[model samples]
Structures are given as structure tokens and as C-alpha cells.
Target: MRICLVASNRFAIREPFAGGLESMTATLARGLAERGHEVTLFAGPGSQVHPEVRLSPLAVVEVSAAAMADRFAPGPEWVADHHAYLALMLSLARTGAEQFDVVHNNSLHHLPVSMAPALAVPVLTTLHTPPLPLLESALALSPDASRFVAVSEWTAAAWRHVVASDVVLNGLDLAAWSPGPGGGPAVWSGRLVAEKAPHLAIDACRAAGVPLVLAGPVQDVDYVEREVVPRLGGEVTYAGHLTGAALARLLQEASVAVVTPAWDEPYGLVAAEAMACGTPVAAFARGGLAQVVSPDSGVLVPPGDVAALAAAVVRAARLDRRAVRAHAEATCGADAMVEGYLARYAELGQRVDAA
Candidate 1:
């Protein structure tokens, strides 16, 4: 199948990925390419995705996560650049639709979703985040609502009324993350933002008397300076932003992975990654974390309950690491994700041809 993947222009789809969405996009594109499917990825400038997958650059300049985070109140230059990038993406999708069998949009922007009806090819948009006003508004205007796919059941439930969407859980490359030497400390990995709640992970690990290693891009500098930096020392160490082998090593070395999300995470990719490395997770039972972390793989505590989280961390550390790895392999591997999307693409293609 000829597939055109639309990625966000927020950052280049290269190593040291900005977030889970970028990582997932890269994994899916590569997996499909390796399976002999013709894949073209439209991403930010300088994106170094799989050599097998064709690259179609979007933005001329890469936008950092920190800058993207300030979208609500961005400078004039930032706003102009972002709008231009969006325009380019929409134009590409509009003009290039007939060239591909399917257009899979991972770009969080609404323009693609809103424009899906006019395109010649089917557009399958995977919703990575919960329903926002902007996206919900665009979805309302979308003609073919069934093209949307939510990353989790929780996310689907949140926006079912706006647009009927299939639930396809996010997945990672399980083979790349194998069981490793695990006598190390607990770990927390994600964007260093308030919603991700890295500080909460720190508090829980400290209370449990477990050393914690925090790793990810500092998405919010003020949040880190005010909340994270003060808590980092001795038992709590910051490893900065990591990706690829570095990230896999951190997860493999940990006895347990700690996930504390302030918001309702659409899907907890880090927890799945940790479990893939044969490391049990101790995650707050919020949003999709509740759906992803099974009892055999990890322990879930009430959201924001630091005491319960701490206790759960201790219990999780004792879980069978082999079981954790097996659970991840069975449920959220990259192969499974690609298969899910392919099935959806075939179905959508049939619908488009019928139309």
C-alpha cells in the first residue's frame, strides 16, 4: 500500500523525539516500510526517519517543544511561521491525496481533519490527545467522522459524541527494548511539564525510599525551575532528554517505572515502554494508564495519592519482570499497532472507493 503519513511540524521527526506522538509516528512509518509498504512521511525540516520511508519535509525550521508549548500566547514571528507550516501541510494533503492509498495524519492540528472530506483518498487521523475545543470544533465540521481513530478507549469516550472513532492503542518497538540488568532505582520518563507531573513522581519515589531517575525534555522551564529543580538531589536525579537507545537503557536499568500524569493522558506510552523492558510500572490510575497497566504488568494507584503511589511502587518492584515483558509483547508491540492501522486503512479505502 502507498501510505502518506502526516506528522506535526512542531519538531523534526528525528532522534531524541520531542514526545510520544513523534516516536509513535516514526515507529509506525518504519514498521510499515520494513513490511514492504510504500510510506511517505511529511514532517518538519531535517527529519531523519527510516531510510526505507520517503521523506517530505514540511517546515523549513524546526520548532522546539518549549516554543510550541507557548502557542496560546506566541510571538508574531512564531505565529506567522506556524500558520505557514499549517498551510503547507494542508496544501500537500489537498493536492497529493490521489497519489496515496491512505493519508494517516499524526499531526495534532485540525486543518487536516477538517479538510478530510474533500480529499480523494481516505484520511485516518489518530487522536493522540484528549478532545480540545479547537479539535472538537474541526471534528464537528468533518464530513466523514469515521476516519478518526482514538489512541485509547478513554479518549474515544471523551469525543464519541463529536466524532465516532475507533480505539487503536499506541504501541512501541518491543524488540528494541529487552529485559536488562535490573538492580537499579525507580524511573520517571516524559516531558518535564506540570501535566506530566515529574514532581509527583519524585515525591512518591522519595517517600517510598527509592532512588528515582527522571528523564525527558524540559517542556516547561518555569515549571521545572519552580517545582522540579528544587526536588532534584541525592535520590532524585535528572538525566535530561533521552531517546532511542539511551531511553531504552534507562527503562531497562530501572526496577520499576513511575508514571504520574496531572492530566488525563490519552495513552501512557512510557509505561508500555517500561513494561516492554521487563520493568514493572507504578502508575496513577488515571485516564489510559488505568487501561494500559494490567495487574500482571504493573500496579495502579489513585491519581495524586502520593502515599498510595509510593506503596504501589514497592509492590510493583516485586512483580515478575518476565510477565511485564510478556504483557507488553502481547498487547502493545509495534507490529500490533501497524496491523491495526492497516486494517483501518483497508476499511476506509473501501469506503472511499464506494463513495
Candidate 2:
């Protein structure tokens, strides 16, 4: 099968610094390529090229420093750039669709869905963002989307009216994220943003009387400045953004993991990754966190209940690390995730062909 993958232009697809969606795209493209499918990933020029997965080089229109500085500020430039980006993605998708057996678009930004109806090939889109506007767009796009997949059941439920959605949880490469020596007391790895509740993890760790190493980039600068900064010190140590060996080491060293999201977490990738590293997770029972973390794998507490969350963290710290590792191996491993996706791809691909 010839597959064309559309990814966000925010960052290079292969850049190690690229976040979860980029990694997810890379994993699927490589996995499909290995399975004898011709896979081509359309992304920015900074994206690294893989032998198995061909890269469709696109000239990234970089937002100038001044433009970026005032991007969020009310301006005509923001609207213009947004329109340009949308146009670019649509143009790329239309051109690329002609050469592929099917199109797998990661952009839930409406344009892909808008273009899908005109394409000769079937188009499947995976929803990544939970923002209300995107949800509205997805609802509008559902009739056009051949098969819509949500990373978490929570996400699926969140937009049930917009489309018929299926659950395909986020997966990690166990070989790369396996447990290693130097495991610490506990770990909290995710964006230091309000929605992620990195501060809640800190509070939970404090209440649990455990030391935690908080990692991942500061995606929300204002939120960090207002909420996360004043609370940092002693029990909570900021390890910053970690990738590759450094990230694996951090996960391996943690005795347990904590993911306490203040909002409805669409998918708990951080929790899954921690479990992959043989570390149990203590997360809030909100959104997809409930779906991902089971009693055998980790512990879940009522959302916003700091006391309950603290207790769960303490309980997770005492869980059998081997069991945690085994659960992740069986559930969140790359093979399992890829198998699920491949099945979906095959099913949807056939549906497209039949139609």
C-alpha cells in the first residue's frame, strides 16, 4: 500500500524535540514501511529523513521574529499566516493524494477534511487536539472523514456528536523506553502547563512525602510563570525537557510516576511511558487516565482530590515494579499499538477502495 501521512508544520517530523504527535507519526510511518507499505511523510525541511519512510520536503514558511512576537496579539498578520498555513497544507495534501493509495492526515484543522471529499483516495484523520473549535470542526468533518480515531475514549466521548469515533490509545516504543538502572523515587514528565497539572503532581508528591523529578518542556509560558514557578523547590526538581537516552533514563530511574491533569486528559502518554519504564502511575481518574491506568498497572484517584491523589501516589510507590512493567509490555507496547492501527488502516483502506 502506498500511504501519505500529513503532519503539522509546527516542527520537523523527525526532530527529537518534536512532541508526542510527531513521535506518533514517525512510529506509524516507520512501522508501515517495515511492513512493506510505501510510506511518505509530508513535513517541514527540518524533519529528518528515514530510509524506510520517504520525506516530502516542504519549504517551511517560518514566522518572522516580530511576527511571532505579536502572533497572539490582535493583528492582520496572524490571520494571514493562519490562512497561508492552511492553504499550504491543503495544497500539499491535494498534490500528494494523487500518488498514494490512502491519505492519513494528522491535521484536524478542518482544511484536510475540507479537501478530503475532492480527493480520489480515501482520507482518514486522527484527532489530536481537544480544543472546542477543533471539536466543532471535527464534528463538521465527520461526514467526510472515512474513519476518525481518537487517542483516548475520553476524547471520543468529548466529540461523540461530531463524528463516529473509535479508541486507539497512544503507544510507545518499549525497546527504546524500557526500564533501566538509576531509577529514582518518583517521576512527573509532561508539559508544564495548567491542563497537564504539573503543579498538581508536585503537590501530590509533597502530600505523598515522595521526591519527584519533573521533566518536559514549558509549553505554556504564562501558565508556568503564574502557577508553576512560585511552587517549585526542594521536593520538586525541574529536570527540563528530556529526549532519547536522557528521557529513557529518567523514566527508568523513577520508582513510580504521577500524572495529575486538571482537565479531561484525552490520553495519558506520560503515564503509559512511565509504566513502560516499569514504573507504576498515580493519576487522576479523569478523561483517558481512567482508561489507561488499571488497578494492576497503576492507581487512579478522583480528579482534584489532592488527598486521594496523594494516597494513590503512595500506593503506586509500593506496587510491584515487575507487574507494572509487564502490564505496559502487554498493553502499551509498540507492537500492540501498531497492530491496532494497522488493522484500522487496512479496514479503512478497504472501505475506501470499495466505495
Q: Write the residue-wise lDDT of candidate 2 on 256-305 in tens digits.
A: 88888888887878888888888888888888788888898788988888
- Candidate 1 has a TM-score of 0.92
Off by over 4 Å in 1: 59-74, 77-86, 143-146
Cα RMSD (Å) per model?
3.9, 3.4
Indicate which candidate wins on lDDT: 1
Assess each prediction's global lDDT (C-alpha) against the native. Answer: 0.86, 0.75
The C-alpha TM-scores of every prediction are 0.92, 0.88
> Candidate 2: where are CA atoms >4 Å away?
59-97, 181-183
**Best model per TM-score:** 1
